[model samples]
Target: MRPLIAIPARFSARTSALRYAAEVNARSLIEAVWRAGGEPVGIHPADTGTAARLARFDGVLLPGGGDLAPPATAPPTPTTPSTTSTPSRTPSTSTSPGTPWSRACPCSRSAAASRP
Candidate 1:
């Protein structure tokens, strides 16, 4: 059996397919996962019963969209400004010991430096 990948569908104000605005996931993303031998499952972005629902899936894909709430603590400033620019690199994936399966996609190359 293919690994089940739970993808949270984003809420869209308007879409071409439906008569009215609806919650949706990108078709390209779904197809890509399927092509890669994983079953993509669209998950409702609700808090109720989420843990139970997610427990059934082998992995979760948190696609980019929506506004992120500001962190409780203030963001830190860079100690030294970068003088040279480097080519953008893909984010590395790592799993924590004894934790649920998870992946990280860096929004920017400087994402690590911004962490307090």
Candidate 2:
């Protein structure tokens, strides 16, 4: 069986076909996972039962969108580059051990290849 990947959907104010608000996962992102032989599951972005749900999946693909809410105590920072001169890199935010988000695989250049 292919690995089941959990991709949390983001809220869209509207979708072309839907009359009301909608939850959406990126089509291209879903296609990429499918092409790579993984099952992409679109899940509601809820705060409860996260760890249990994540434990059921083989891998996770954090979708391209806004950053996850910063740790409550810290001030907000721009995730984007301030100037073109500076090199671009995604900053890592540390989380506590045994948390669901911490279970996500680190995507280093060497680890770009997704696995089940």
Candidate 3:
């Protein structure tokens, strides 16, 4: 069967927080999908029903953007830090499980860490 794909907008009327992405948006990705020989569908913000729609599509692609202001929680506690602590400079092996290029969830990390 022909591949069916859906891309949701990064922001909409319902969006409460400011956007952070400086690069391409969902629309461009949709165009890329068309160029790649797949069907692309755009999703609306208020349409919570898209969940059902997404299920119908062969795949769902959530494009990149700002960090969603998920509910705040207590910060991680720092303990026993001398000089060995260091952030991994290596990129994630894969972000998504099923897609060709595994896409890491946008909310998973801050923009600084993931940028190329």
Candidate 4:
């Protein structure tokens, strides 16, 4: 069986085709995974049960999107203009897996630590 790679779809306030808010994934990412002989699955980020949810997948791929809200303890920085009107499209700092949010999701570390 092909490896099932779990990719978290980004939450968006609006999308062209959808009347309600939507979850979006990158077409290039999905196609690349398929070309590499793996199946890519997009998942919604839940408030709870993250571990139980991730345990079923063979791997994880984190795609970059969304605003970068700095930690409360960090020194303040000047505000920058948002790129788009949508709340989800605000100018983001680096969205690499090393950001503060990763600490909340253990799977980030687990996926980075595991062997292929």
RMSD of 4: 10.5
Candidate 4, residues 1-114: lDDT per residue as tens digits? 877778888877998888999988878777666666668899997758776787777666667544544332234336543332212211232233533222222233333344
Could you arrange the candidates by lDDT from highest to lowest?
2, 1, 4, 3
The stretch of ten residues in a row with the least summed lDDT in candidate 2 is 82-91
70-109 in candidate 1: lDDT tens per residue? 2311233264333222211233644443333333332222
Per-candidate TM-score against the hidden true structure? 0.59, 0.61, 0.41, 0.54
Query: Over the stretch 1-116, how does candidate 2's per-residue lDDT look in tens digits?
Result: 87777889999999998899999998977877776777888989998888888877766677644564433323445753333223123325434565555544333222345533
Best prediction by lDDT: 2
Cα RMSD, each candidate? 9.8, 7.7, 10.8, 10.5
Off by over 4 Å in 2: 68-116
Candidate 1 residues lying further than 4 Å off, grouped into runs, are: 69-99, 103-116
TM-score result, candidate 2: 0.61
Give the clashing residue pairs of candidate 1, or none: none
User: Which is superior by TM-score, 2 or 4?
Assistant: 2
Candidate 2: deviation at residue 100, Å?
5.3
What value of lDDT does candidate 2 attain over all alpha carbons?
0.64
